[model samples]
Target: MRDFIGRAMMTLYFTVCATLKSGAMIVALRDPTWSWARGISVAADVAALGFLVLIVATTVARLPPVKTAQGIEPRLSALIGCFATVTLIAVPGVQTLPQLELVADLITIVGFTLCIWCLWWLGRSFSITAQARRLVTAGPYQLVRHPLYACEAVVLFGIVLRNPTWAVVAIGAIVICFQCRRIINEEKVLRSAFPEYDAYARATPILIPSISTLRELVFPGAR
Candidate 1:
């Protein structure tokens, strides 16, 4: 009974969030002032919204939570990181630095593109909070344990480059701290649910892709 209600509520949450954000993004994209480079931000938003909408699909797919770490810590950490990150990048501040817009835009595009790919790869395994919809060990998962969040970190780094401010620096720091913790909490659930997760974790890096992981692709015992 409680589980059913919880799933229903989550479905509603994702639907509403994805719809509202997508509508706003469409409007923003249609604005005359927005250049093609600015489309990267929209792409980032779409990637996030796409993931949220996919969360609803997980509910419909009836993928049960094999394990979930659902205390305040996991939830609060992710919320704080996301909130801080969004606010720092989205909001305009009083002081603006002389930014290399093209470089920043390119970085952001790569980051968000990777995010979208990973999110799509995850498919129904996607969830905002620390919960295991299912175990996915292919595609981007082969490179890193949490490729979505890893690429998001890259996105935030590019955002900081665009808006180089003390406030942004402080908030981005907080975002990184919380996001790293969110990874731990998420892994707790994945490790709990899938027995094969240990071997996967051993092979892949946590967030950063490394030469060793790449080398292992050929040698299979390079580590």
Candidate 2:
């Protein structure tokens, strides 16, 4: 029952973020007087919404109903923190929208693509509950250890660049910190549950992609 509730809460959280971001995007795109910041916001919003949908659908489809927990779970707190940080980013700040630049557009496009790739990599392996069921070494995992989070970081960095406000930057930083904490905690759990996880960690980079690692993953015999 606890696990079920946690999963439900997580779903609700992602749904709310997705809805908020989508609404913000619609507003940005439809407004004739949209500023540069507004346009960037619109891109970020769309990317976030699309990512959330992918994450939620993939997660719920593979994971079984979570059993209810008896007490507060650390993962729940981390989840809430993540939600809060993302919400802060979605909210508009005091800065006026900057003028649109070609470089910014290219960055945003790349960021969006990375997020999509991250979601694709995380397919069927995503979960909200505080349990480590399996060590996924296929797909994106074969490329990087935490591709989803890495992609998100890239996307958020692009968003920050588009709207170089202190608020947005701070929010992005907080979100990164939250993700890092979650990653650390999750790694601890995974290491304990799966003995081979440590070995995998030794060979794989956590977030950043390396050409050599990519080669090794793609061509096992080359390494």
- Which candidate achieves the best lDDT against the true structure? 1
RMSD value for candidate 2: 4.0
Off by over 4 Å in 1: 1-62, 86-99, 215-223
Residue-level error in angstroms, candidate 2, position 147? 1.5
Name the regions of candidate 2 deviating beyond 4 angstroms: 32-44, 65-73, 92-105, 128-130, 215-223
Expressed as tens digits, the lDDT of each residue in 41-83 for candidate 2 is 5565566677778766775665552222223554664665467
TM-scores across all candidates? 0.73, 0.76
Model 1 TM-score on a 0 to 1 scale: 0.73
Estimate the Cα RMSD of every predicted model relative to the unseen true structure. 4.1, 4.0
Instruction: For residues 47-81, write the lDDT of model 1, one tens digit per residue.
Output: 55665565577655555566778778898897687
